[model samples]
Every structure is written in C-alpha cells, then in structure tokens.
Target chain A: MAALRRRVLEVLPDLDPAQVTDGSSLKELGANSVDRADVVTMTMDDLGISVPVREFHDVRDIGSLARLLRGHLG
Target chain B: MTTRSGVAPDGVVVTGLGVVCPTGADVDGFAAALRAGVSGIGLRPATVDGEAPGMRPRLVADLRGFDLPGRLAGLPQLPETTRRAAARVAGRSPLAIQAGVAAAVESWLAAGLHRAELPGERVGIVVAGHNLTGALAERARAGYQASPAHLPGRFALWYLDTDHVGSISQILGITGEGYTVGGASASGNVAIINAARLVAGGELDACLVVGALTALSAMEAQAFHNLGAMAGAAGADGPQQRCRPFDTRREGFVPGEAAGCLVLESAGSAARRGAEPLARVAGYAARLAGTSLPEPDLRGEVGVMTEALRRAELIPAEVDYVNAHGTGSPLGDDVEAAALRAVFGPDRPGPWINSTKALIGHCLCAAGVVEAIAAVVQMRGGFVHANPNLDESIAPDLRLVGRRAEPAEVRVAVSNGFGFGGFNTSVVLTSTTGRGRPSAARR
Candidate 1:
C-alpha cells in the first residue's frame, strides 16, 4: 500500500493528499491510463515484485491494487 | 476583423516566440540578452565516470539551474488547463522534453492561442532535431543495469525523440498532425520548413516549430572533442573568448543546451485573433549536401542564401541583416564567409552580419529556431547585436557589428543554419512594418 501510494503521489503530485485513501480508484483520483500504468509498474519495481498483467483485471481500487501487489510477495 | 498597423492577413507570419537556452527562459528575457550580447558560455567542471578523468568537452553553455515548475509558475497568464496538463504530461520527463515544453508553452501563450484558440484540429506541431535521447539513455542505463525491472515505467516513452511531439501535443490539446524532423545541427530549420509548408498549404492554420534541445552525453561530447569539432582547451583569455565566430583566432564551436519555439500562423489566422505579427516568413530554402561527412560546402551555402533571397523576391542588397550559421568552427566560418562574399559581393557594405552562437553558444539542433527568434527580435527591435568577442574579424570587409549594439532599420533579415551530413538552410524574415514586403501566398 505504501509503495503504491508513493508512486501514485509521484505521478500526480497535484492530487489532494487526503483524498488518496483506500476508497479511491486510480480513475477517481484522476490518473489517466498512462499515469495508472506508470504507477503500477513503478510500484511493482519499487517492491521488487511482479504481478501478472492478467491478475490486475480484478483490481477495483487502491485497496484491491495494494492487496493484489501484496499477494505477489508470497 | 480589425487589423494591426502592418498586419499581413494572408501571408505566413511568426506570431510568437519562445526560448529556453543558457541565455534566458522567456522570449523577452532572451531578446534582452541578445541585444546586450550576453555570453552564456562557461567552463564545466571535469570529472570521471566513477573512476579516472573523462574526455567530455569542458566548455559548455549549459542550462545549469533550469527549474521547469518554477518556469511554468512564472507565466501566470498561462491557462489553468495548460498548467495542469503540462505537469501531468511532462512533470517527470527528461531534461530535453521539459525544456521543450517550457518553450512551447511560452510560444503558445505569446501567440494568444491560450485565450482565443483555434480548433485543436487546426493547429499542427513539428519537433526539430535527432539523437536527442543519448543523454536520457545514458542516465537510464545505470538503473537498468542494476535491475532491469527498476527502470522508470515511462522510460519506454521517454527514450524516444517523438516524446517531444507527444507530450507537447497532449499538453496543448493539439489534435492536428505532428512529428519530428532531423538534420544534424540544421534540425531546427528543417522543422521550420515543415511547419511553414503546413501553414502555407492551408493544411493547418497555425503550426508550432520546436527546436529540440540538444544535450550531449559525455560520449557524444567526447566524440566532438576527439573529432576536433568542439572547443576543448581554452587559451589564457578563457572559455568566454573560445567561441568567437568569424574571428581570426576562432578554433571550434561550443555546445550549448537550448530549446526554442516559433508559432508560425497564417496572417489571416493571426489577424482574425488580433494577434500582432512579429515578422513575416518571407522566404526559406533547405538544400542537402550529398556526403555524410561533416565538411562545410561553400557552393551549397551560397545556393541556399541566393535561393532564399530570390524566393523572398528581394535582392542581396535589400537584406538588412544575416544571422550567420557561424558556429566558430574554423572551416565552417571560412566557407560561410566565402558564401557571403559570393552572395553579397565586395563593393557594398552588405546586411549587418553577426552570429548569435557567439553569445549563446552553438545550440546544435536548436540553432535554427533560436537564431530565427534572434533575427525576429533584432528586426523588430530595430538594432543588430554585437560580436562581443570578435577582437579581429576574419572577414573585415563584411559589416559585422562590433563591441556595442548598433541601431539600424532592420526590415529584411536572413538567418542561416547548416548541419553536418549536408543540410544547408536559409530563412528570410521581413518585419511586417511595411518597409519590407510580406511574402506572397503559396508558390
């Protein structure tokens, strides 16, 4: 979650800090397709892990994205 | 629609200008530095690549302290959407794209497109220069070497030269055609020719021609030094005196990092928006030398100048100024001098000749557009800038400006750009103040 948050903020520095919570979707947080892909790849790189592209289909929001990335650690 | 004093409602005119060079970040600031002949050349500290000493060229007119966010903030008149879009698209891009965006934004606003914009589909864009990614590649390599997955996610897009075209188009909301054009150091002029053709052909009413910043990597910089094409060891007079174009003691060119933009709009398009025309693109010509070697061609140089003047429908004598492609390279300057002699002849004191490279260093890919902006500013300001470092001229008979700025009625101006691999371009610009005739509609 922390890595994802950090990368998200880095991509959209103008995003309201308080609004970047577990409830927000990347789209709700104003990240377009390029920005979203960038955040996912950067977050995965930062964590030294890789989640397959197909597994991301079920990811719905920041919470789900963070959980999916966390599941890759096992 | 109401018309300004010297508006050309049908010709192609330069309605806006922008620059991000070692000289200045904004057009106004850039123009002031030009007239005052401020030298941006300075010695860069030498060091090794994590080991022994290196071979990079020591002298450079670097964009040392550039802060893009700060630059964007300085332009409070920029539209909110533009400011936001700029950050979103280019916030984490490479240095060259950042500089290109800064220049593009200034020109867009200066052209009054921010307030009363044309349809997005009607505005095209052209990014000039090539091999713009060596620096970015050099920087990204270490991270990739450490961990292939550790590279920045956007490195894929960032490494391409077309990023300049993509990012700027997204930020500006330009839906018209866009692409990159390259011609070694003559890249900027080639891009301008493309943009002008689009506007003149009525494919687009306005086009943005950006001179892509050329930031040489250590390898690239060393290559120029090794090739004896860049000034390396400065004499006792120091680095400032090293890049003395057209001077007797000139050695070679000094590489300067710069990005520039000129918004070329049809006079009818500009006049409809009540945009004031800074200068009309009277005529332009670009010719290629067949060889891939870096030799300067006198005949090719003279051909472009003569053709440009002829296209502008002006005789050599009517040209009030020439912004020389004088990069301080020994052979380059010599051939250009011979070309000038051929075009202007001996008897009359021809147009005031000077090299902006003497002040801002050679901006490589950005040279043409940067020098074109310098010409437009000089033509509009009614004065020619001085060659501050030229203590003795190699060609004394030519009317090159000396230590101080000289006041003159500059109406017709010709700016030259020549690149290695045989690209020679000359662009003629006439101030739209009635003294010089505006260009006719497409030929």
Candidate 2:
C-alpha cells in the first residue's frame, strides 16, 4: 500500500494520496476524463501494469485504483 | 389584388465577405482550409502563467499574424489599453471599435460598393462579442496584486458601452438603427437575422453583420475548468485531435478567437448599384430552447430549423448541406446529432454535415457568422468540407463528411448557430445563379 501510494504520488504530485481512500472517487477529487487518460498512461509506463480504461470509470479513490492495478499486475 | 404595404419585398442578398480566423485571415484561406479539411488546432505558446488542471485545449485556428487596418493600427494594441482609450473617447471598448471598422471595410469592398456613392447614413452595422477584454482583466489582477494603489482607470474602461448598432454607426458613419444582440454563440446569427429584417423591410440599403470573440482570462479559464468542460491534457493528441465533433469518442469543445463580417444588400439595391450577389438570404428564424446554459435542446433545434426551412418553402430534401453548430462537447454533439436525425428523418438522403468548430475552436459569439461564411463558400463553390478527427460514426447514412470535400449541387444550404440560454437561430442560403425561382418572384 505504501509503495503504491508513493508511485501514484510520483505521477500526480498535485493530488494528496492521504485523502485518496479506497472509497474515494476521482470525480470527487476534481479529476476529469482528461486526467483519467493521463493517469492511465502514466501508471502503465511506471508500473509495467495494464488496466483497461473502463476500470477507472468507477474508481473513487487512489486506494481503489491501486487495488485494481494490483489485480491487473497479478 | 395584393396590398402594397402588407406585401413583403425581396429578401436581402449577401454581396461581400471578410473573415479573420485561425485557419486563414480572409475568405479565400478560410474556404481553402475547409475544402482541404485542414485542422487548425495547436498548442498555444504559454501566454500566461497558470496551470489549468486536466486537458488544456490547445487546438484553435488563431489569428496570429493579422495586421490591423491602417485606421485601427494607431489604437492601443493591448485590449485593456484599447478598451480604456476607446471608452474615454467613444464611450465603448476598443475591441468593438476595431471589429466594427474591420467588418465595415470588408463588407464594403466585397460588395464593390464604394462608400462615397452610398448614403453613409443609411448603412447600418451589427456586431456580436462574448467577452469584454481578457487582457484588461489580467492587467487589473496584476495591478491589484502588486499594489492596491496601482489600480488604473483603465480597468473600468473595459465596458462595451456602444451597442452593436452604435459601434457600426461610429465607424461606418451609419445613422440608421444599430443594436447589439447578446445570446451566447447565437449572437452573430441573431444579429444577421435582425439586419436582414431591417434590409428586407426597406429600412436600410445595406447592413454589415460582424461577430468577434477573444480568449478567456485565467479566471474565466478556471471557471471552465470547474465546470468540467476544459479538454485537459488529453488534448495534446495534436491539433486535429483537439476537437472531434459527432464522433462517438468526442470529449469537449476547444476555445478559439475569431471575427467575421458579411455585407448584405437588398436585391433591388444591389442590382441598382451593379453589385454582384454571392448568395441570397432565403430565410432566417430564431427560437429559444428553455433549457439550462451550455446544454442544447434537440426538440427546440428541430422545431426552429424545420420552421426556417418551411418559411423558405424548402423541403428537407432541398437542403444540400448543413453547417452544424457542433461544439465538440459530449452532450452538445449527441443533442445536435439527434436533432439532425429528427428533422431530416432516419431514412432521408442526409445532407452533408460538418462542424466549422473543428477547423477553428468554438469562437463563442462569433461562431455563427464564421460558420455562416463556411456555408456561403460551400454554396457558392459547390462542395462540402469534411470534419477532421471524426472517428466515431454518428448515425448510419447520416453522411457526416470527414477529411475530404465532396462535390454536390448545393442550391440551398442551412447554417445553424445555437448559443447559451437556448437561443437557437438558423439561416438558409441559396446560390444566386443556380436553378431557383427568380429573385423578383421570391420577393
């Protein structure tokens, strides 16, 4: 969880990972379709993990996105 | 026997054209860009310091190299300075004065009507703008931040006090009725409709219709960001990728700056003055959607558009092409497509449809006149321009022209411009020399 938090923070330092709980929504954090694309692209390049774009549609927070990424990595 | 006063005279004709857009500075370049399906979207060199989160829409047909006319060249180059000076002297902002003069000159030259020959007092002007002056707001912000006492009188000078009609009267020496209409993107079309009514009623021999809008300031940009409307960084996919209208993957609209002008004259007056007609203004109509701002009402669009066609005595089949008010927004694109399908029907031979917004970012209030120019050019030149980056098919057999010009016999074309607050307007244009009823009979 710590390693994933660090990784996500490295990509979007403007956002606070502390507030991104498992139940947090990206839309609630001011993230939009454009930001989602950027985050997806950056996550793929940095973590060598591939997640479908639609998976992020319902992701509310960084913790949920991280769990989803872990499942893709496995 | 028909009554004399009750009978409507011949409709007005478009005799001249002038445009300043990101794709080209004049009608020729604008037309060529459209015909060639060139995309004008691009990354703007950072003009200011503030990072707008998300997709930063960069694709826009920007007028980067335009030189002001000799008369306007002496005015302040910065919008803030110009607005202040113009307000002090003419009781209006500088942008209005400059735009008014440019449109008047272009219309006059296009009509081949010498200013000296016509009654200058009878020539009227109507102009539309979305924002007052972003540069002025920027200056005020910087000044207040630096020191409270540094605030200049220039901040208050940004008001466009002269209505559209007043600006035209001052610049072109016109004395007839002049007024500005404010209705979001439909502003330009509404102005043109008003001008046409006045000309058709024999209220004026000629009228100049102009539309102009500038880029958003940091504050305005932030407001758009908050609305979830800005394209964000995904717009970096290249200029052509910035605006995709009617495409299923479409995201949002790109902001752009532009100004356009058309010289309209009554057919009788044009003939008397030996001026060549470019296209005839067959019919004009406007309606409101009663919807919230920024979202389109498909039913309203269909009702007003069909009514305009009916007024012109045109069936859906007679329309050869449509210049769509496709803003590239998700909701807007869907609504517009639905409206087109409803009006023309699912089975009819669909008119070639494309968005001028694809070539130049949404020019806000000026979009109507700018798109009208595209329709006029296609009608006169007999070809429909394609929409770029339209990856998703809108509807089967809809014929949304993409990335190429298609040759067609365009006897009649409909140009639509819908603005915020559900202000909807549609203008119909027909070829002057093509197979149609004589101008006299239509009158």
Q: Can you write out model 2's per-residue Cα lDDT over B1-443, one digit (the tens) per residue?
A: 11112213776899888777778756788888878887777766544555643434344555565555433443333234333333323332344345544555565666765434467656677676656466456755764675543333334434443444554464455666666767777887898898888788877777788876555665676567567665543534765686788887677777777778888878877787788888888877899888767778888889878988888878776787888888878888788888888888866677888888887888887888888888888887788888877777666568798677788778788888888789988888888877864333343
Each candidate: how many clashes? Answer: 1, 16
Return the clash pairs for model 1, or none.
B9-B268
Candidate 1 local Cα displacement, residue B336, angstroms = 0.3
What DockQ, between 0 and 1, does each candidate earn? 0.51, 0.01
User: Per-residue alpha-carbon lDDT of model 1 for B1-443, expressed as tens digits?
Assistant: 22122333377999889899898878888889888888899988776454545445788899978888999999889988899889888998889999999999999999998885688888889999889999889988887897776566677788889999999999998888899999999898899889988888877888999999999988898889889999765468888888989999898999999999999999888877889999989889999889899999988999999999898888887888999999999999999999999999986778899999988899999999999999998888889998988899999989889978899888889999999999999999888885557344213
TM-score for candidate 1, residues paired by index: 0.94
In model 2, state the lDDT of residue A34: 41
Q: What is the C-alpha RMSD of each candidate to the true structure, in Å?
A: 3.4, 19.2
Off by over 4 Å in 2: A1-74, B1-8, B46-59, B69-100, B144-158, B161-168, B437-443
